[model samples]
Target: MGSVNAISKPTPVNPRLSSLPGESFPVCIIGLGLIGGSLMRDLAAAGWPVFGWNRSAHTVKVANRSGFDVSGDLDATLRRAEAEKALVVLGVPMPALPRMLEAIAQHAPSVGFTDVTSVKAEVHELVEQHGLTDRFVGGHPMAGTANSGWDATMSGLFDGAVWVITYDNAKNRGQRGARLWLDTWRRTVQMAEAVGAAVVPTVARRHDSAVARISHLPHVLAEALAVTGDMGGPLSLTLAATSFRDGTRVAGTEPELVRAMCENNREALVKALDEALALLQKAREDIASPGQDLHRLATEGHAARMRFEARAGRKVKDAPRRPIIRVQPGAPGWTDQLSSAESMGAQIGIF
Candidate 1:
């Protein structure tokens, strides 16, 4: 693995220093994929100026046409961000994080940065090793569709989603700069609220474990289902129903990205799979027995699913403050929707 070299350390200023109210900050997004593009849309709609960069010129062009200020040159984007004292959002893959940090330290040292990568521990270590800890935060927006790329982005993608922010104990030690961070948090919360997702706070390890169970495990299960059905005759597959289709939905994900996430988070995923297998084995054993309490187990599974749904619904309702921006039944013009939100005292971010 490549390592980042340490640079000169800055004086230990209080990390918890307060932020001024209504202060506008420039944001630099390094990727124009689904998450980055959606973030840009939300930030721009909320009236924040944004600068975007992508490895592909075509991606940048598409973002520019969609009303984002995109730069094809990485150096130029860094220069622009340094000039504006911006917050840089890294939306690259896990394996790309070390090099990205090195590049940022070399070209954009003055800008504060954050990443949207799913796995946090390794990336967090890289940021610290590069002596950019204070100026960086780990962000993982818990929202996305099965789609990828800028063209798949929608302004409401993050609405009502939990965007996890992770840091070392150092960053959250005081309440001083908590408000400034909260301003950024508030913007993200509003974005989630607008999209219909609930915001939840969690530590990195916790986030990884939870997602491994709910998200990663499901992808694995979907792949297993798809593979099993492949062994069946074509006629059998033709008779698959809605539940079969839905259950195997994520099996169609981009192969590379899915493989990367699974490999990177293998430990947590393995543990989750073990637990799931144990439960399945118990169910199987019960079904094999003539006098098995099949009804009880079925009831237990149903009750568990109901509890999960209820908790998820309650969390969504409790996460955000009142006065959320509501979208009508039909798709309206972007400007008109934004204007409506602004009039209702809702902060909206559009990229």
Candidate 2:
């Protein structure tokens, strides 16, 4: 990565390239799994001529059979994207990101890029190594079901969802922070917001660290709890109801995905796990006491959950809160001359 001495409009360094708007530039989705298929569906429905490619011939056949424009040839897909000045969104699993990056680097080195992959830091690093950050912005739509593949995909899945964008806003950084100066990056943000997703910006490492604690850790804990409860006997499964089912439902998600997430985010997840164990230990100690301590913990947890729900709604107070003052009849500032109700009302033009 190189830095510019001064701020400048981004150039392709290859003069023929234009910074086209996302709508004018076609979108070539390199994978048609859950997130990719949903993106393809929504964009095509919105009137953008979308193109798709996939690793599986069966998946390609399924998409083409369903009346989508697609091709299995990686080279052809890259050529069309280059001709159209398209943005390519990689929607494969975390494990597949590297191979796709390698292919894209070889075939379409100049095309703009983003991904719907959950992990960020590693992908950002890979993009830098390929020198593709000039045309790449790392993105993760913080939306999904615990489901996988094309059949599980649906439109409007990103509505009202927070789309985490990993890019530095700072200057002085070149390839790694090209997102700051690139017209293509702005268009990508617009494209994401156009899909009814709110874009939240942060650096790649920060995105990964936050996701590990919030997203990956929960999946880990859910699977752990499900297994722990079942250790008692087969009867435990029969006894499981709403609470048990809802709490551990993610435990049934594709094991390969869970394993990949855990492995990729091990460091931050381990830290989150340590914090969770400390809290669990505190809960255990409080449960032994069973009256004040446990009650207080539960009360605090309930309050936090309520606060979370409240904050998730629209119209949260984004500005700093201010203090309010009330003046009464007997207060120090009160003067009998103006304190008369009629006199004050007349002065203030109020009744």
Candidate 3:
């Protein structure tokens, strides 16, 4: 639970790493659950060898049985990655990141590393503390369902997803290494494209805040809805429909992870909740008044939801095609222009 110096934007991939041959590298994924197992399937299908390990022997056996190269020994897993010059992806929960990074630093110092933790600030700090900044990148793929475990994983999970990458661009020591990292990202992006996800850029703080509004807050609200709707009445429970179930679906997530993420990002989440509460209070007041613009809130919410659904549908249909507008150098006020363009559905290249 340490602090990481916040990075403002996505760093450009190191030219050096990009210059390497288009050869595949072995990848070691720890924790053969949803994220890890999905990664293993995609990478293996892409012609890259994948090794995996999990705390549960049954999970490891399942991965192996499913034709993945898996082992139960942590050191053995690291050794395999070291022998193959591969990146070890830590796909476990946030609480396990520090210990996993420590283990990697001590046992497999030379291997490149990354992770799939939703919250990155703490994990980034842990990697820095281990002096492995040059060899690691913090990653979070913005895709998942209310599911867990190796059995639940699929190859198409990350298709067209925004995979956030956070790193120390200020320090130029890993420029060449960063390129390789991006090459790996290109593969991930391709997978996302294949699966109907749109690649987007976001820093750790921005990601946390945005997710708090759309993802985290929904979970909290859903749980609240479920609790308020049913007070031990079978009739109330039986009356639930698709809309009600969909609205409260995320409430089914592991409570411990929900608690951890909420506690870690409490500040941003609190602000989001407060804003939502204010809007709700205003709506209630307006509804009770003689001449209040209650319809304005309804209109805004309807418009927003429509826009979101439209964008989601477009992203799914356009997954196979590369972004149309690549951000180029020498454009006047290119940064602002590109941002504006992207907001309007133009796909700008990631620099």
Q: Which candidate is the best by lDDT?
A: 2
lDDT of 1 by residue, 1-351 (tens): 122221132211111111222334678889878898888887676556678898888888777787689988887788788788777889877777777888888888766677888877667678769876656656778778878888888876765566665533224423544433433443433333433444344445666777789888998999999888877879769998898899898998998878988887787899999998988888898989988857867898899999677546333434444233433211345335534543443433323
RMSD of 2: 15.5
| lDDT by residue (tens digit), candidate 2, 1-351 | 234521232322111111232334478998888888987877765556689788788888888888898788877887787778788888877777778888888887677788888878888877778766666778888788878788887887766566666544223446544433354555555556545555555667777777888788889989998998899688898898898898898898899889988898777788889988898899998878746377767888899889767546431123111111122222343233223322222111000
Q: Judge candidate 3 at residue 331 and give its lDDT.
A: 41
Candidate 1 wrong stretches, greater than 4 Å: 1-23, 169-197, 313-351
Q: Which stretches of candidate 3 lie over 4 Å from their true place?
A: 1-23, 167-198, 231-243, 315-351
Model 1: how far residue 58 lies from native, Å: 1.5
Model 3: lDDT of residue 172? 51
TM-score per model over all chains: 0.75, 0.76, 0.77
| Cα RMSD, each candidate | 12.8, 15.5, 9.2
- TM-score between model 2 and native: 0.76
Question: How well is each residue in 1-351 modelled by candidate 3, as lDDT tens digits?
Answer: 122221232121221122122345567888878888887787666455678789888987777777888888988788777777777889888777777877887778677777888776666677778777766666777777767888789976766566565433213546665555544444433333333345454445666777788777887888887787777578878998898788777777888767876777787789899998999999999989988878889999999999787556443344534344443322445446445543454443433
Put the candidates in TM-score order, highest first. 3, 2, 1
Number of clashes in every candidate structure? 23, 0, 11
* lDDT value, candidate 3, whole model: 0.66
Best by TM-score: 3
TM-score of 1: 0.75
* TM-score of candidate 3 relative to the true fold: 0.77
